[model samples]
Target: MEERLQKIIARSGLASRRKAEDMIREGRVSVNSETVRELGFKADIGRDEIRVDGKLICAEETKIYVALNKPRGYVTTLSDPQKRPTVISLLPELGARLFPVGRLDYDSEGLLLMTNDGHFAQQIQHPRFRVSKTYRVKISGRLTGAEFRRLQNGLDLEDGTFVPDAAMIDEINPKSSWLILNISEGRNRVIRRAFEKLGHPVLRLIRTAIADLQLGNLGEGDYRFLKGWEIRQLMSPRRQNERLGKPWEKT
Candidate 1:
């Protein structure tokens, strides 16, 4: 059966669906020795030869899902061009290419999901799913009452409005303060950016959970395969909506 070239590449575990689309547009993907740059191009895996960057791809026989406790200073990518340490270096070679479901900043640490299943990655990362991520952040100073209310009501950032699902002051120190925040959107450095805009500036940030999946005693830099039941719960749309108390509508 014919399938979209990008979908085929993602199913082959070569890259995520989004990355595969970019590869196709860059003219790096070819079908039957002919470079095909059209995003809608399709081919049959069994009959047509499909190659990415000149390497033939085959359907991946096994799908892998992993939960990694990413440590600070490690890049989230499969490989870094500047020879920096990557999250892949912490995992034992499982013989399948696994890409990060989303990303955690290089300076932040915590639970990060990795998978060979492109569909799963796409679903979890898509904003429409509204998967909530919880973070424990240390900011330079405590937030005043007005500032806290602004964060709760939603703050207008240069990019868009950021309203955390939940926010609380955990502790206040002489020089810094700790806060717990939950947000469904995955904007780039959003937590940090929000705090910076509020004049508190994040000093440290660590993701503690994603949906029902928790970091839970998982040692830093350690990785474990996700349980079957956990994967099922994450994939269920009904369960996702239940967690947020409403269906997510894209703005």
Candidate 2:
């Protein structure tokens, strides 16, 4: 299928559509070895020999989608300036410069989507996507029913505030409480902060699901590519609406 040059560049994960247009206008993009600065320039992605600043970019190879059952102690960044172990290091065999779609803090673990598909990545991270991400969290102490209700309502924290789309105690042990938390907001440390504001500290956090997608039996530090149908479902507007529902709807 043919697409605008900038669209292809955005899909390549180099930049967003707007940024790609800037690159094109700067005479950085070319088609068939000829510089193309026209904003409306189009090309058949599979047939065109496109280059960005003299480097060929394969549009077909631009998209890569993988899900990782992230283990603790790995940062969800491409490469840290501090040289911390990064998520991309785990996918050495993937042979593509993919990035984590959203993020999972070093101490948190579970289903994290990695991709080179810029538009897809942007869609997932965009607040408008409203994708529900589910996490299994183990907190240090048990909370009363009222305390749990407070979390569902929303909590104000020192750093910020947060509210889980859905939060419940799935399993209760003597010393630890296991909770299932679904959140639409991708704020940093949201789940942890919500519980902290309620005076409960999280000991462990594991992302178990994203929308209809589940981590399933994926082991720690293990990953698998998203199947074609799975990708389609995640991108479909209908499915997104179904997963997110309308604003103010209860989780």
Candidate 3:
């Protein structure tokens, strides 16, 4: 069956549908020997030589989904023009061109979903799917009860407002604090700014979970492939749509 070009790239795990669209627009994606920029273009994955930046994508024997406990300082992109270290640099054995589903900022690290299945990444990362993302954040200062409540409600940032799916203080120390923040929207550097607005600066932000999947015991910079059941859960529409409905759902 024919699928959208973005979908093809996404299913190959090169990136999410939206990011694949960006890659298309940037002339990094091509069909056979021609550059493709239209977002809705389609092709048969088995028959076409779909390439991204001149490298042909090989369809996987089985789509691979991975949960990476990323350590701080790696960029989430497949490759960076600046030659900065990236998430893909950490997994030279993945074989297929999988991509990080959403992203973790260069300095922020935690549970990062890596997959070769673009549609799965799309469903999980797309705002409409309402994927749940949980973060364990360490802040530079103490948070007031009112400030914590404001986070629970939502906070306006330089980009936009962020309404956390759930927000609460997980633990507190005299100099540092830990809070669990769950949100659906994958806004850039959202968690950092949410506390910044309330006079609490984020020191370290690590994602603890994504949807029903937890980061659990995965050491920093370590990763593992997704199991069959986990993949089925991700592909299931009923649960996915249910998670996506709540505006505050975790990403």
What is the number of backbone collisions in each predicted candidate, taken in the order shown? 0, 0, 12
Reference-based TM-score of each model: 0.73, 0.73, 0.71
Superposed Cα deviation of residue 245, candidate 2 (Å): 13
The residue-by-residue lDDT of candidate 1 on 77-137, one tens digit each, is 9888899899989988898888999999899999999999999998899998898888989
Tens-digit per-residue lDDT, 21-57, candidate 3: 9999898988889899888888887898889989898
Query: Which pairs of residues collide in model 1?
Result: none
Q: How much lDDT does each candidate structure score?
A: 0.88, 0.82, 0.81
Deviating ranges (above 4 Å) for candidate 2 = 1-62, 158-161, 240-251
lDDT-wise, the better of 1 and 3 is 1
- How many angstroms is residue 191 displaced in model 2 relative to the true structure, after the best TM-score fit? 1.0
lDDT tens per residue, model 2, 6-78: 9998888878999999999999999998999999999987898999988787755647899999999999997
Scored by lDDT, model 1 comes in at: 0.88
Candidate 2 matches the true fold with a TM-score of 0.73
